[model samples]
Target: MKIIVVNDSVYPLTMGGSHRCVFEQCRELSALGHDVVCVTANEAAVARVQEPGGFYLSTYRRSENSLAKALGFITEPARIIGAILREKGGEPVACLSVQMFPSLLGLIWNVPKLPPFYYVYHGSYAREMWTQLWPRFKRSLKVSDLLGALYGAMMIPVERWVLGHGRFPVVVLSNYTRRQLIDDLGVKDDRIVVVPGGCDTQHFSHSAEGRARIRARFGVDDDTSMIISVRRLEERMGLDCLIEAYADLRQRSEKKVKLVIVGKGSQRDYLERFAYERGLSSNELAFAGFVPDAELPDFYSAADLFVMPSLAVEGFGLPVIEAMSCGVPVLATSGGGHSDLVAAIAPQCVVPQATARALADALVDIFSGRTKLPDRSACESYARQFSWGRYCSGNLAVIDRVLAQKSPPAQTRA
Candidate 1:
């Protein structure tokens, strides 16, 4: 089957959870002998498209001018419509992978020619924005905060309308996201398909030699305990909470432990300051700062445990699975999508969010050998179930079902 995957960004260009997930899906689909063309933004287009892959890639550059940026806010749907028409030529395309802004664009522009598009609702942006905004308002009252809240409120109605009216088959990355779409956005239960995001299990799995090499390279002593947090340094990630938790753990534990923070973001300075304020030395907390993909496995294997303290804004915590694949025990917050993934593998380690004491306690338990770590064999076994190959196959099955139904497009009364 011929498929066109449409999104604002793709892998190599955007190295985040969503970008990686979409790229994996495309790769898997291509492996299954499907002709896949991925359409992404042109900023990182050349780099991403040049990679050796089975799927074809095409990109459109959005203008960077101030006027264009302002216009894009209103014309995003029209732009996607235009791109689709140009890409389709005169032949009918079978399906389009539309999400977020592009999903709404597909609804508005494709109208009569709309294919059986699959909407991957990674998560609700408005909800995330609101989550951030509420905390700001509580901390300090500001005109900017009020304006941001107003903007979020304005987008909520439009987002809900697009989800409700599109009526396309929806593929969600987590059960949490699926529930939000059905309960908050009023999307039909039948239309929603829960295809949890996956990791490259075989690629990420641990080897004894690889683990030893990684530890040696880091100058880590055999007895040293390593705690790794692989995530963007963003407020929603709750890195501050992790640092506080680690500080609390250090106060209680006599063992030698180090925190390795991977990935970089806007909150680096703030997180650094927070660490210093907690009296943590540079050796105790190392901000590795954006390790490349090829070196990711080394870091994962180098760690004794992985912790994701993200309180919210997480549709699916991919690192937890990656760590588990590396035979590393994972302790993640019982909030958002992490709850679902961690519960499925290591329910005992799922702790309450923002509870630094609980996080510290969990870490101490692992370090002290009080709580049994997740069975390495079981971790490997559970990780195998969420391979990219399985993820794409499930998605293709949904697309085929959506296309075969042949339901007439629901009319919109504007």
Candidate 2:
């Protein structure tokens, strides 16, 4: 099978569950004897010379803001158009596209050849912007968040069209996203396939020496409790809520705990200020910025618990699975993809309400010994099922099915 995926970026080159998920799918497809070509706009990949397995052809320079992103989208079609022209066709290539820039543009650009394009739908960014930004806009009256929500509101129709068009098969990363397509946009149920995203279970598996080293690097001692989160420091991530929860947890408990927040974003200065306002001491909280890909495992190994306090619906929490794979218990907000990861292992820890009081109570239960965490071995076993190998295999199976339906078996001579 020849697979061509068009998306904004890939992992290491970029961060985010969607970016990493698509890259893993492409990487796995290439390893499974398919010629995979990833056409992206990630600045890091654009600067690089080459990659292993298949290859990368960039469409735009790296983007940091919405305005730059819109301009980049305007230029994206050119590279993809050239790539399509270069392909020597035999069997129809499966062109996989996820929701970032409008899928309409990709389909419109490829209309001449009209390749067998498949839409691998992640969560709707428009829905994300509206859900996560509107409240902030309402309260702060910030023009920036209003503009973000307005952009999302404007794109809702595009997203709706992408999901509902009968011609394309929508591959969603989680059942939550599948529901969004159906319940929110009226997409037919059969058109959507729920293929859960995966984690590097083996890489994040427990390591004692790694844990000790990571603790030393962070200046956290063995006796101190460590809570770690690797989520992007964005508004929807609920980092502010986590800070409030952490402060409440600190005041209630006699034991001192260390909170290490990793990953970088515009929210850093705001989050730091908020933390201090919430009475979090510098020693109690540390922002490690972005940990490199090579050292992420050690950070997970160092965690006593992993927490995902997302205020909005996550497509799938890859870090939740990664931390669980490392034998660390996870506490996440209920009512989103976070439940998909926690249900089998730490179902009880899903905070019913995503708020400081609720989160603090859950933390108190675990850290204060009121609620015992599930066995580390059980957490490891549950996480093992969500490996990248399994995810890739699932992706291939669906694409193979799609191709088979397109080209039926020829009749034999009587």
Candidate 3:
């Protein structure tokens, strides 16, 4: 079936997990003999166009200037409608997969076309904004916290309107998000589908040779234990807590453990400052900011342990599964979807949220060889469960189901 997937971002842009997930799913879908056309904003369009694959691509200027950025917030639906009309040429558009911003546009435009649109709710915008705002303000703009909170408050209505009025089957990345849609948004159980983010098993597979090369490239000695965290340097990521915990672990551990932080964001400077304040140097913490996707597996395999100390609003921790695929044990916070995934794979490793002491203790346990690493075979097994092929198939099935059901409500000429 011909499918049009709508998201604000896609691959090569390297913005977030959702962007990469959508791009990978689309690539896999194209490989599975489906004609898939991806529509993204200007910022991500160039990347998708450059992707060496056979998928139809359309890019649009979603916004013009800074002023347009704020105003284009309301124009997203019209832009999507324009793109659909131009591309589909009146062919019965099968399914519309709506991400966060474009879901509203899909909801508004689908009213006339009545296509089976699936709302892929990654996480609640309100929760994400709340998690990001306070820490960012405290670290960067202390006075801006109130303004950030107000902005979040203003976004509530828009978020509520989209979730409430979309009236389409919801595709959530985790069971945790599925429950949130049901309990928080009052979405019915039958209307929700859980298809978590997937990994390219081959790309992230366990490789001893690759690990050795990556270690040598990073200047990490073979005898030294490596702890890697592949996440944005942001407040919600709990990097501050991770750094504090690592400092504590350093004081006690006999073996040398180096923390490798991958990815870059606004909070990098604050984290660097925090590390300095703790009397740690660049040697103890390596900031290999924003490693390319191709090189991610090396980083994963080079590490002895993968750490994710996210506090909350983590819809699904993609890196955790990637690390698992690389046969690296993971330790994550018992918050949001990370708790669910970690529980499923290795429950003993999930520690309390924001508890640096608990995180430090867990790290020390792994460092001291007191806690055994997860079974390599089991790790590989879990990784198989989240393969990109399975993810694409599941999503395609949902799209087919949605398309077969109904079109958008017909529009009455005014």
Candidate 4:
């Protein structure tokens, strides 16, 4: 099969769960004997490069001007994909659009010749923006966040039309996202396929040396329990709640515990200030900023426990799976996709709510031996099931089914 993947960004060049998903899917499709062409806006060393996984990567530079940005997003990707289609010259193909904007614009730009599109829906962008920014806008009364919320609010209708039109196939990362589409956007159940995002189980496995190195680097001793969280330092991530919860936990628990927050974002300064305000000492809370891709597994392995304190839009916490894959127990808020994975592995590990009280109580329970967390082997076993290979295979199966349904007539028309 010949597949053209259209998305705004690519992984490693630009990091995120969605970008990683796009890169992995394209790589997997190519690996499975399909000729794959990925057109994205991620600037690499070259405009067009062939990846080791047997896929072609075409990239475009991002513009500094606002109007240019919008125009480029619509035109640049379409132009690249148009060139690829012309080169193929009537080959049977399908489009795997990773984002709505690119898909919508690309379809408009090349309506006559564009192939059947399979939308890789990663959750509603408008809803995510509203969920993440509205609360901040209310609290801070910041003009930027207010405008952001409005923009996101406006996207709701646009998403509804694009997702539901023609009843196109929409691939979601979790059942949580699938429910959102049905309830919020009124997308039919059959059109949505729940393919839970995966982790690199092998790359993220337990490493004693790595564990010791990371722990020692952070000045965490063997006697002290290290609670780790790997996420973008943002308000929506609930890091503030985590800090408050850690303070509460520190007050009650007799054990020596430390919290290590990983990843960097605009919230770093705010989080640092909040940590101090919570009366947490430097020894008790350490911020490790911007961990590289190669070293992420080590950070996961260093944790005795992993926590996901997402306040909202907690769409499939990839860190939860990565931590579990490294033979570490995970506890998360009882909502979103990560909760599903955590609940399936150990029901007791899911925090009852996203509040500080709830999170703190759960931490206390685990430390005090009141709640039994899963063992290293158990976590490893459960995480192994959601490997990237399985995710890719599931995607390919969906593609096959969609293509079969769109049979000879559709192929001839294209």
Please name the candidate that would achieve the greatest lDDT relative to the true structure: 4
TM-score of candidate 1 relative to the true fold: 0.86
Model 4 C-alpha lDDT per residue in residues 1-414, reported as the tens digit of each score: 778777767776666677788788888888888888777775442467898767888888876443344446667777766666667456656655546464555566564666766777766666776777787788778776777677777767876776666566778888877887788778899888888888888888999999999999989998999999998887778999999999999999899998999988868888999999989988999999999889988998999999989877766778888898899999899768778778888999898789999999999999999999989999999888887888888788777877777667543453
Per-residue lDDT tens digits for candidate 2, residues 161-226, read: 756765667788778778877888788998777888898876788888989998887788878989
TM-score of each: 0.86, 0.90, 0.88, 0.90
lDDT score at residue 150, model 1, on the 0-100 scale: 57
> Candidate 1 deviates by what RMSD?
4.9
Model 2 lDDT at residue 364: 88
Residue-pair clash count for candidate 1: 0
Q: List the residue pairs that clash in candidate 2.
A: none
Backbone collision count in every prediction?
0, 0, 5, 0
Cα lDDT of model 3 by residue, 1-414, tens digit: 667777666776545878877887778877887777777666433423535666767666655332244334446544654556556454556667777653455447544654556877888765666667765666556555646555666676667776766567888889988887877777788888888889888889888888899788767897888899999887788898999999999999889888999999988888999999998998888889998878888888889889989887777888889999988889988867767888887887888656889999988887888877787788878888887777787788788778667646778999
Model 1: pairs clashing at backbone N, Cα or C within 3 Å: none
Error of 1 at 166 (Å): 4.1
- Runs in model 1 deviating more than 4 A are 42-51, 62-81, 86-91, 102-112, 130-150, 217-219, 407-414
Q: Rate the local accuracy (lDDT) of all candidates.
A: 0.76, 0.76, 0.76, 0.80
Collision pairs in model 4 = none
